[model samples]
Target: MSHRIVSKFGYYSLAGFAGSALVQLAVIWPQTWIAVVALGAIALLYFAFLLICIKGVLKGARWAGVLNFNVLGVDAIESTGIVLFFVVGGVWTCLQIL
Candidate 1:
């Protein structure tokens, strides 16, 4: 409903999407045509949802607030997965550099 809420949602959604993508890529270790295609499809759908949320937020739709809240809840559940992914990936990257 409010612009502040919309902006917060947009920021969180973008962050969540990035985190999810990273985790997906790490888990799948894409190495084949099917894997690439599937990842691409998943990316497309993810972006679509993000776009819808953005549009709804910009338009100040009440439904957007509801959707944003739901997304936040989902993100919270995925937070653990994202955190683990980040921790492992960060350590791996650091070790490689060292």
Candidate 2:
């Protein structure tokens, strides 16, 4: 009972985090049309996953966890790449301008 409750909490958190990440990426890369279109496609696919999880959570589908874990993996990788580009890429850009 408690585990399901916690999983539900985590599920909502995942949705919120995904929303924030997608919005930030879109805003940050609006000038790049290819990136924007790619994001749109990814967002559509994620929405499908979200719908599936929401519908399956009560029925106890293991596939929900699998999909959630995969989404989080991608999120983690994306976040790490963002941090790298923001830090290292910024430094490199500064060095080049100097």
Candidate 3:
């Protein structure tokens, strides 16, 4: 039951992220068509995996929940790394100036 809930949330979040990205790309239009194309390709691949997981969940595959947890875990790690990088960088700069 929890797996189904998480899977549904993942689907909606991924869709929302992709939609917002497209809107942003449209706003920038001509300047970054190359980037838009690259991101679009990557987004398609990401969506494919999510769809596969969705299918697995619907079919009662145990691995689907594991895959979803792994994906979300990696995302959490990546975000934390980014935040730490900036925080440490700023602190290092301040210490150097002192």
- Candidate with top TM-score is 1
Q: Model 3, residue 62: what's the lDDT? A: 79
Candidate 3, position 68, lDDT: 39
Residues 3-62, model 1: lDDT tens digits: 987775565555545545544554556444355356446655665676677688788898
The lowest-lDDT stretch of 10 consecutive residues in candidate 1 is 79-88
Candidate 1 segments exceeding 4 Å error = 1-31, 69-98
Error of 1 at 29 (Å): 13
Q: How do the residues 9-80 of candidate 2 rate in per-residue lDDT, one tens digit apiece?
A: 565555445545444554566665465356556655656665566677656677665653443365644543
- TM per candidate comes to 0.39, 0.32, 0.37
Q: How well does model 2 score by local distance difference test? A: 0.52
Ranking by TM-score: 1, 3, 2
- Rank all candidate structures by their lDDT, best first, as comma-separated numbers: 1, 3, 2
Q: Write the per-residue lDDT of candidate 3 for residues 1-98, one digit (tens) a residue.
A: 67986775565555445545544554557565565456556555656665676688777787876763543465744543343443344334334443
Q: Model 1 residue 13 lDDT? A: 59
Whole-model lDDT, candidate 1? 0.55
TM-score of 2: 0.32
Residue 1 lDDT in candidate 2: 69
